[model samples]
Target: MVLGWRRRKNNNHKGVKQNVEVIVPNHFMCPISLDLMKDPVTLSTGITYDRQNVEKWFDEGNCTCPVTYQIVRNLDMTPNHSLRILTQDWCVENKQHGVERIPTPRIPVSRFDVAELLIQVKASARGLDQYGCLELVHKMKRLGNEMERNKRCIVENGAPGALASAFDAFANDSIERNVNVLEEILSALNWMFPLKLEAHKYLGSKASLTCMVWFLKQQGLSGKEKSIVTLKELLSFGDEKHVEALSEIEGVCELLVEFINKRISPTITKASMRVVWYLVSSSSPCSDKMKLAFVELDLVSSLLDILIESEKSLCEKALAIFESLCSIEQGREKGYSNYLTVPLLVKKILRVSALTTEYCISSIWKMCKLGEKDDEKRVIVEAFHVGAFQKILLVLQVGCGDKIKEKATELLKLMNPYRAHLECIDSDYKNLKRSF
Candidate 1:
């Protein structure tokens, strides 16, 4: 309760009344919180509640009005301007009573407004100057960033599709001159993901696909990282036809590999690797084309380099990519040809994480099992040489999933014959090293 002076008129004159407590009118308080309504809004049920309280009610999944308990037919909360005015007036009258006046809340952007902005975006795409176009995008981005509801409304109204289409158009014309505008468009679209179905189709277009490849090619470009991450998100949307089209694009996977090899930033590297893995693993008959592309680019060598230097998270991603590569014959040959292959795979077992251990052990099995007899024996000998036998034994002893356990047991069986030879070799080396 606030303290204030109350005015009482005598028979002939008015006089000040001191130290009177003021009571807030009941209607001014929220039904839920019993606090004064800061932003009053009336529901379809003809009941007025504080905007915050009503929105919280809806967010909690309540279908009925809090007071009436009747199903709300329409969820729109119309702002009660008159009630707000009165509430503000009351606050002014009680200023000395420590009452604070509520300021008017900013209205959320409506779908119609978003649609109008998108229309302007389309028009800008046609013939507007690059500066003008960029200004519009910046405006749209500002709107999206203003409030969560505004962002949701903007996304729900096809911002992604509009931005993607504009980017595609610019890409088809001349990207060299429109680089800044295109980058801004990409940045705008990045905020709109996970994109709606229509936006996915837009990004999936040939022009958009080519644009993404161009972005990825420009190392150290301002928006290149965003492009990489956006491309990965697009691929993850699981459109088979789009995945196929992307895989068929020349140098797409290769560029991704090159980006990963750069290790410019951990985020960019991880996102690029995810894109590579998804494209090859996506249901594209062009998947083989991508895998071949990756192999030709010497992706295995890059992955091994990453595995040796990376921490646990990057190790997991690199190993996953390695496992996918090893599924094919050329990849297996490439992996085995690297002397670090068996030893590195052995070292990672039961070390990084369960998933990494799985990938490592599985990759080793695939590489050794599918090669020629002589190559197989060589890999086995290398495995024993690297203490792969001892690690696999620990893997079995510590216990694991059936799949990994089977892999570990199989690896032990394959290397069993050479275990003693490996031991003797170790002893001999220990004794023969006279001068180091």
Candidate 2:
């Protein structure tokens, strides 16, 4: 009887283990949200899951049964759908708004109120605390949006002169005060309404540029400081039309030239280079002041130096500036060779070869094109230290298989006629022709 009882107990234990092996397909839900396991947070007890405890999860390309811990084969448990659902819910909760969301006072607020708001925005930005600035940016964004929607109301009825008057006051205030406010507004708008049409309406306007330049000049910003000011302020000042007024400033060109000469921080120097490029690209009448500035600053050499040191983007801008300069009728005159000549340009091109692949190719293409156009073919021949044909043959030999080589080859064929003066070409023509 004792042996029979022990055998029965063992059978019962085996039966209980079999029952435990039975798997449930959907046995549990997250307690917090009552949804399928999201962030399946584990606990210290090793038996419970919680939402707050979980950071994130990955399926590893298969689903594991919550109860039996068996991997579900041939199941597409990629988790992409789960992530989308979570993100969609998160966005909706964060962006949902009500009618009374606007924060401006019902009554018209005074200029001082705007000034105070601007000060707070500046303080928040200076601290570099994103959360601290968020509230102020939201408020400004709401105000700017409201003003735009009611633009017809303000401009036509003139009911609330307060906001318009405040803007005018800010625009005409002392340089330091006005610029500080403008900077704050710009920063706030950039953050709060990035890519919003209302943001463009608020920030991109002629009035803004007028005010900004006035403030910049009043602060006596020039050279690197002026470059920085332009760099930070241009996008907020709208598009190409706004550039006209800024470009017309007496010292603006000189400031750009100084920026190029002093080797300002690459960021500021790049910005200054862009400003010059736009000015030249527009085909605006070249002012005597601009020319004199370029001459005084020795802009050609400075630009070449930048081409040698800067990355491809800056080098591209520098090349564009060079092209624009050459496009002007006066730029094509004989005397201009004093600034841009075959020897100096060749040296600069060689220096650029070490900078970037795009820059090196561009420099080579420009040099070859210049050779084809130059009236002084002797200068090109002398500068390359070989006969024109030999130079072309050497370029073909050392070519890197970039598109620029093709362009260089085309220009070489054009300049080959000038090779009649070279002794090497006469002796090597048959061999060169065979190779070609």
Over the stretch 240-295, how does candidate 2's per-residue lDDT look in tens digits?
54455566555667666766666546765776777676665553455334544464
lDDT of 2 at 148: 42
lDDT of each: 0.81, 0.44
Top candidate when judged by lDDT against the true structure: 1
Model 2: residues with Cα > 4 Å off, grouped in runs: 1-169, 172-174, 189-207, 214-239, 283-297, 329-375, 382-410, 420-436
- Which digits, one per residue and each the tens of the lDDT, describe model 1 over residues 1-436? 3423354434445465445466788777788778888888899999999988888888889999999999998988899889889988998988766677878777778889999998988888887467778999999888888777788888888888888878878877787888888889988887777987777877888878877778778635557788888888898988878888787677777678877877777778889888888877766677777787898899888888777767898889889888888878889889878877877787788778989988988888887788788877888888788778887888888888898788889989999988665662221121221111
What TM-score does structure 1 among the candidates reach? Answer: 0.80
- How many backbone overlaps does candidate 2 show? 0
Q: Using TM-score as the measure, which candidate wins?
A: 1
